[model samples]
Target: MPVPRNSKTTGSKQLRPGKAGAVENARPEKEESCQAKRSPSSPQGAPKKRSAFGDLTNAHKNQAGLRKKDATKAGPRKAQKGTAALGVLKNNEINLKKATRKTPPDEASAEPKLVPKNDPVLEEPAPVQAPAIEDIDKEQLGDAYASAEYAKEIFNYMKEREEKFLLPNYMEKQYDISRDMRAILVDWMVEVQENFELNHETLYLAVKLVDHYLVEVVSMRDKLQLIGSTAILIASKFEERCPPCVDDFLYICDDAYKREELIAMEMSILRTLKFDINIPIPYRFLRRFAKLLPLPWSQCAHASMETLTLARFICEMTLPEYDYVQESASKLAASCLLLALKMKSLGGWSPTLEYYSGYSSHELHPLVKRLNFLLTYQHDDKLKAVRTKYSHRVFFEVAKSAPMDMLKLEVALKS
Candidate 1:
C-alpha cells in the first residue's frame, strides 16, 4: 500500500460503507453542476467566486451579444442568393398589380371630343390659298388652263347668252346661270370656306352662284349687294322650296340690302339661268348616292353638304349634269369633310364615323381610303391654268346655307 499522509490521510478514512449506505452517502451536496473545462482569469480587480469544495471549476456559460464593428461584411453567396430570391418575389407581386390595374386615358378628364378625337394626324399644311383677285384668268390663276384671252372670252360669251338671248320657250321652266361663271363661283367658294373655316354648305353654294352671276353680267361694284342677293335667290330656287322673296332677302341683309336693287338683279340673273328652273345641284346627287352607298342618312347629308362646299372650289362644278354629280358625289363629299376636318386640326375621319356610324371609326377606313384615292385623281396638275378655273364668275355671290323658309317667286307669267 502507498504511504499515507499523516493527519490528512487519516481524515479521508471514511470509506467501505455497506452498499445501500454507500449509495445514500454518494448524493451531491449541490443541485446541478456544469461540466467545466479550463477557465480563463477575470480582469484585475474583478470579483471572483470560488467553488464550495475549493476545486477548480470546468463549467462555462455563454451570453449572447453583438461586438462593436467597423463594417458588417456581406453575407455568404448562399445567404446573398436567398436575399435576391426574396427581392425577386417582391418584384413579381408589384408586376402583377401593374398588369391588372386599369389606367385611365391621359386626357380622360377632358370633355367629350366632338370631331374624331383619335389619331390626330395633321402636319403644318397651309392650304394653297388662291388669289383674292376674282378676275385671275384661269390660265394664270389655276394650273388647269392657259391663255388669259380664252378665259375672258369665255366669260363674255356666257355673259352674252344671259343678257341678250332668251331661253327657248320649251326650256323656260328651268333655272340657269352663266355657264362659265357657275363653275368658277363653286371652286372659289370652296377655297374661301377652307380659309375662313366656315362650314356652311348652303352659304357656299349660294354665294358661288351669286358671285358668278355678278361677274357674268357686270362686276358693277355698286351692284355687288344685288348680285350677291340675286345669286342667293337663284340658289334658293334650286336648293329650297318656297324660296325667299325680295322682302325676306332684304330682312336677311338685316336692312343693309335694298329691295329695288335685289329685284333688278334678280331679273338679270333669271335671264342668265335661261329660266330653265330645274337645274339640279350636287345636294340632290349626294342624297341619291349616299343612299346607294348605304351611308347613314345624317352622315351622308353632312357629306353631301361638304361636297357642295367643295363644289364651290371645283371649276367644273358649275356644269354639274346629273351624270357628273352621280359619278363623283361620294368622293367629293368625303374629300370636303376630310379637308374641312383637317383644317380644323381635329382627329381624322374616325370620330366622324363614330359619331355618324354609331360604331368605331375603323369600320369606315376602307371606304374612306377609296374615297381619298378618287379625290386625288381629280386634282389634275395640268389644269391649274385653265381659263374657267381661275375666275369666280361660276359660283355664288355669298355663301350662306340657304334659309328653309324662302317664299316661292312666280318669275314666269301665271298660266
Candidate 2:
C-alpha cells in the first residue's frame, strides 16, 4: 500500500495503509486561523504560480520602462555637457533652481558658487577680433545703394582703364587752339554747368571730350567754341537725366553755331572717341579719397567736410591749367586731398589713404607741393570761375581758406 500525504482541501493528515498504519499529525488551529485572516474577501480563485521564464520576461519589461524614464531625466544634462564652460555655468544655474524649489519657504536659499574669470576650471572665452581699419567698404555691405561688394572692383577697373585714356602734351600737336583759349572754354563750361544745374560728372566728361577731341583733330580757332558746346552736349546726353537739346547748346553759344552744325559736331566727337566716353574724372576720384578723412574725432566730421571742400577747390583749379593735363586723374585727386588735410591741420597721409589711393606720401610729395603752389600763387586772375564759385558759403568758403605755411608743409612731409 502507498503512503498517504496531508490533504489541503480537508486541512488534515492521512495515514498510510501499510504496516503499523500510523496517522499523520494535523496542522495547528492557530496556523489555520492566520491563513484565513490573510485570504482575500472576494470569491476569486488563487493566483497561478509563475514559471522562471515568465518572471524573467516581466523583469525585462519593467527594466525597459525604467531606462526610458532615466533617459528623459538626463536629456538636459547631456545638452549642458556639450557647451563646454557655458554649459557648466548653465548646469550650475539649473542646480540652483532645483535646490531653491526643494528648500522650505522659511529657510534661506543656497548661495550659488560664483566662478572667477581667471579660474583654471572655467577661464574667460577669447575676445572677438576688431574689424580692419582699411576695410571701410565692409561696413556698407548692408546698404544696397553702396554697392560695397563691387566698389573695390569698380575702382580697380577704373584705374586699369585710365592707362588707355592717358593723355600726353597734346597741345604741342594742336596748331590753332592755345592753352589760354582752352582755359576760357573750360571756364565757360563751368559757368554753363552752374547755370543749367548740370551734374559735376557732366562738366568733367565734357572737358575730357574737348581735350581728347582737340588732341586728335586740329581745327580753326573760331570752331573751338563749337567743339566745346558739342562736347558738353554729348556729355549731357551721356550723364544727365534730361540732357539739354542741341538747340539749347546753340542758344548757350549765342546762336553762333546752327543746330545742324552742333549735331554734326556731336557725331564727330563721338566717332573720334569711338563712342566710349566713360572717362574717369578727378572729381569722382577726389570724392572717393576724401572719404578717408575724419579719423575718429568728434569735431572731425565737420572738419572733414571743410577739408573735402578745400580739396575739391584745389582739384577744380587744376582743370583749367594746361600743365596738369598729363597728370593722371587719380594722382591729382590724391594729391589735392593730402594737401587739403595738411592745410586743415589734420593728420598726414595715413596707411588707410595710401592703401586705398595706391600712392605713398613720398610719391605724392611733389604733386602735393605743386598743388599747394597752385592753390597759393598760381591762381589765374583772368579765369576766376572755380575760385569765385567755391568762395561762396554754400561751398564752405574753402576757396578763400588760406594755404598752409611752406615750412610747416615741408615739416609735415618729412614727419
The best candidate in terms of TM-score = 2
lDDT of 1 by residue, 45-92 (tens): 312333223325433321111221212333466688988877876879
lDDT of 1: 0.36
**What is the C-alpha lDDT profile of model 2 across 190-277, one tens digit per residue?**
7766555566677888999999988889888899889988888888788765576766676667668787888898889989999999
Q: Quote each prediction's TM-score.
A: 0.28, 0.67
The TM-score obtained by model 1 is 0.28
Count steric clashes of candidate 1: 62
lDDT of 2: 0.72
Question: lDDT of each model, Cα atoms only?
Answer: 0.36, 0.72
